[model samples]
Target: MAESKDLLQVLWSGADVLRGKMDANEYKTYLLGLIFYKYLSDSYLAKVYDLLNDETPDDLQEAQKQYEEVMKTEDAKDLLQELRESMHYTLEPDMTYVSILNDAKGNSFNREKLQAAFNRIQESDELFNGLFADVDLYSNRLGTGDQKQSATIAEVIKVLDGADLIHAKGDVLGNAYEYLIGQFASETGKKAGEFYTPHGPAQILCRIAMTGQENKRGLQVYDPCMGSGSLMLSCRNYSTEPDYIKYYGQELMPSTYNLARMNMFLHRVHPENQHLRNGDTLDADWPTDEETEFDVVTMNPPYSAKWSAAEGFKQDERFMDYGGKLAPKSKADYAFLLHGFYHLKQTGTMAIVLPHGVLFRGAAEGTIRETLLKNGSIYAVIGLPANMFYNTSIPTCIVVLKKHREGRDVLFIDASNLYEKEKKQNVMNEEHIDKVLELYNNRKSVDKLAYLASYEDIKANDFNLNIPRYVDTSEEEDEVDIKALTNSIKETNKAIKESNTALVDMLNNLTFSSSETETAINEFIEILKEV
Candidate 1:
């Protein structure tokens, strides 16, 4: 653990090397990509040393030396093939991050070598295609000229070279990567939403979605609008058989998609287990191949963002069940929800975060809500506190759904007041999250905190599904002690009258230093006498 902390400290210093000169979004690409490159290089050399010598080497430099010697031997081709089969990628000596860092130390580093290395990685495997597409070593933003850019890139590499990833465990490195992602999200503000989900809500989403499926082996989880794959990755923490868990996700933004790809690899997800894509999840339905539906589904799509919502979308299988209507063009919230919902197994649970508008907004959204409610798909609604997100302060809700559940009764939990006020944002700690889970498990009405509404209750409200309409968080006013309050007021007035009379008498005895003082004292005495 201490070693991991030190590694994190070493890794974060790379951010300091490029902090002031770069934007948070831009610098995160450089910082995370460089660190990821170091991980690959370090892990590669360590694996080679282990395979060749049957022992893990303590020093990466020594491993690199031995690896170079081996490449010149007759077994090199066999070693490369074994590497491709095991790690899904292979690195050349000249293209390795260790080699590049050594060159940086010798003042011989250049951008083209790093670019070649990136191209080699992309070419080495299908999983790594365009994996490092967002890292721009040649960008003018790095510096004013090519020489300066090379120097800047070299500086970043050196700053990240101290992490000792060869000795680090998977979770250690994965946690360090997650920490940097969170820091970037904090600094990037609104743009953060494109690639990151805040940790608090992420915990709630994963825990709720993985409640009963935690112990189940071979759990397949999918996220349609996965941001950085954090929400989907979060499910691993709740599982008893995490190694058997498979992940499927899609994201709209390419840069954000690339981040998710790197995030999956950093978390040590098996290449075969990571099924992610960079495409518009709503523009076209996906996962039309094998294993389309999953054991668990989660989403945090862009809230109320505009989509084409063309008439042609009515034919999309994901939306066709809703009486020939699609989500409106102005708000894609329901579009994303239905996309994830369509791919959920009958026994699986899904959790989605969106603005409060989705609960009560009439017209097309209302019709969709009614259909979902009548079908018993909407299971539970959890209201989160406002100012909880990096991008927007509007309070959001998590709508939990299960396909063909037994009843239309929905659990509504008003956790809006359940968070602690952290710096600039509201955070739900473990205690708060546990309370929510407890409420969900109990599935009973708690005064002002949660409510279990019957289908008739929701229908009476015209299928509004608004939490406040179901779970009234309003507190009843405390009964007034009128007689006791009157006596207290009389005693307070009596005390004030006694103090005022004493003050007036004291003022009358004071010898006036000037006519102005005498007049002021007289006016104050008159005011006090009236009081």
Candidate 2:
């Protein structure tokens, strides 16, 4: 805990320096990318140290030579091996974070040199060619004045250098990185919400997807919109089952795509076991020569982004197989849903976070919604409260899909009313998450909160997956007691009259005129009406 605490402090210091130096929008990429790089470098060094423990490699040259030779013969080019030789990064003699920081204190840290180092690191591994594609190290956004950028870079380095981030004592580095991402989301306004998903909501998504799987044997997992890999990582954090858990994901944003990959590496998820990608998932370049399938799929794709419903897509296997047309160009939410549904295995389960519009939207989205619901595999539709995200406060829902179900009804949970309020955000805590998961697992009706909607019932509602359409989310007005209410109103009127009389007596004692008093009372009443 102490080590973790120390690391957090260093991270906060680094963030403070970075905030002072760079623009709010760009700091996330630079700082998070650096932390990820540090993780990779440290992990690589640790592997090298362990290999040289019993038999000293004499020097770095011998170490590098042996590592390459051993890697060539191995059946699987392990992550550790790939790190040493990959084109994503080039490790110079003294260029790790610690080494550069040491040198910077003596002389002005060469900004070009640091940038070059970063380039070399990324270039060292071709697989990560555009990993840091979003970061513009030389961008003027940092500052037009050269002096300010240099100072900002230096401060960032100084703060990170002093931070004890190399050790995986806890999730200190990961949490700090997430915190910085959240800060960036807050500062960037609307555009920021696209890349950042708050950790709290992500937790609920994870819990919902993995609810009953804790008891199940093998629970393979995946995410289609793997922003920062936070949702997938949450599974790794909360899961009790050991060997059954595996993670896969894809992301569209280049820089965020890199961060997700780096996050997986930090969490020690091996490259061979991971299926992360940086591309448009809707077009479908899944990581397999054959049809690949997953057991658990979770995603929060860009809400209603436009895309070419390519004329050819009508014939593409994923959508055509369902005998349904691709969602219209106006909304891409159903496109992602179709992609997720196509990738799901026959015996698998999936949960996806989508905007509320998907529920009742007409045209192509409605057509696709009807198809998914009529399949009889739709398990649950959970409505989340508004303002649960980093920037946008719009309400959202998680659609749970499963190929195999023990019952014929779909469960609808109206969690729109259950949330813990923060200053500007609404969070779903452990209790809230647990209750949702419990209802999902139990598959029971909870009065007006959760209900099992029949296939016929849903079909009757015109296939609208909205919570209010199924779970009866209306508060019912608490069955107002007419007699009690009337008594309360009378008492309130009497108290107000008495207070007015007392005020009149006070004014009369000061020798005020009746007309003047009436005018004053009228003015006070007018003011109070607005208040």
Candidate 3:
């Protein structure tokens, strides 16, 4: 764990070199894009070395010489082809990070070389197309002129080159990349909502979505609002066959969409298994001709961004089933929800993060909530603490939904106060996450903390699915003793009287030669009597 922290620190230090050159949001593109490039290059070289070892088993020195020689000749074509089939991308010998660093050390490196490398990478596969588009090599943010821009990028490359990315375990490098994204999220404040979800709640969603699928293979996990692909990747934690899980996601922002693609590759997820798209998930429907239903769907979309909510949408398949009313045009919370729920397989489970208003808001939202509850679509609601997310402190909840649940009971977990305060945000430790998961998996009620509400119970409340209504977490007030309080007041008054009498005596014992002194002592005695 300590080593991981150290590695993260080293990787993040590269960002520090660019701190003054650009904003955290912009500089993150350069830093993360370069790190991802380095990873791809290192990964390619590692595969080459492994293959070389297989060819020359006895002599390590001979293998090194042969590896360099073959990479320069047409003989390396077969190896590159095999790598393309497996890794889905290839890096030329001169395009590697090592070559860039060596040239930078000789003061011969420039932004044009990096630009060429990025162009070649994007051309290598459809997965990498426009992957580095956000990392503008010649942007003025780096510097005003070509010399300044080249120097800054060169310095960044030199710093990243110091880190041992090639030999480190895949998780170690992937984790470092995630750490940088989180740091950027913290610095970006509310804008972080566009591209990042805090790790704790993400874990809860993944675990809830993966319940009963522990032994399942070729599991399909998806996130419609996949910000940097963190939640989509979190599903790997619950599955024994992490590599077999196919990842699918969509992001609205072009830059964030690119980030999600880079995130997938950095984690070593195969290109064929990743189906990420860049567009408005609500404005345009995706996976249109492919298998629309997914085994697990997770989302942390914008809280209440406005959408068309047009009358035309009433005919749309996703919202049409939930009565004629659509989520208010002013708030599209339900629109995002219904979109994700539409893609959920009948046997699949979905977990989505939403604001508290969705639980009790009336009008169109209320009707949608009622429709879902009556059909047994909603499963559980877990209330998270305030300030738990980087985007907002409005206190959010994760609603777990199943298409056709056997039972009509909805589990409500009031974990609003179950968090530790950090410098700028509230955080849920592993213990807190596990407790919620345990209570959720148990599917039974725990006093105050959790409640299992039957459909009849919800009907009595007019279908208000607010968590506090179902699971009360308020503390019980201490009972007051009237007799004990009266006795105590009398005892306190008795002491005051006794002390006043003594003070009066002391005042009388003082000699008063002047008329003024005598008048003051008389006043003091009267005041003591009143006390």
Candidate 1 total steric clashes: 0
Give the per-residue lDDT digits (tens) of candidate 2, residues 379-412: 8888888988765678988888887556557888
Better of 1 and 2 by TM-score: 1
**How far off is residue 355 in model 2, in Å?**
1.7
The C-alpha stretches of model 3 lying farther than 4 A from their native spots are 1-3, 50-68, 71-87, 507-528
lDDT of residue 6 for candidate 2: 75
lDDT of 3 at 423: 97
Q: Judging by lDDT against the true structure, name the best candidate.
A: 1
Each candidate's TM vs. the true structure? Answer: 0.93, 0.80, 0.93
lDDT of each: 0.89, 0.70, 0.86
Order of models, best lDDT first: 1, 3, 2
Candidate numbers, best TM-score first, in rank order? 3, 1, 2
Each prediction's RMSD over C-alphas, in Å, is: 2.7, 6.7, 2.7
lDDT head-to-head 1 vs 2, winner: 1
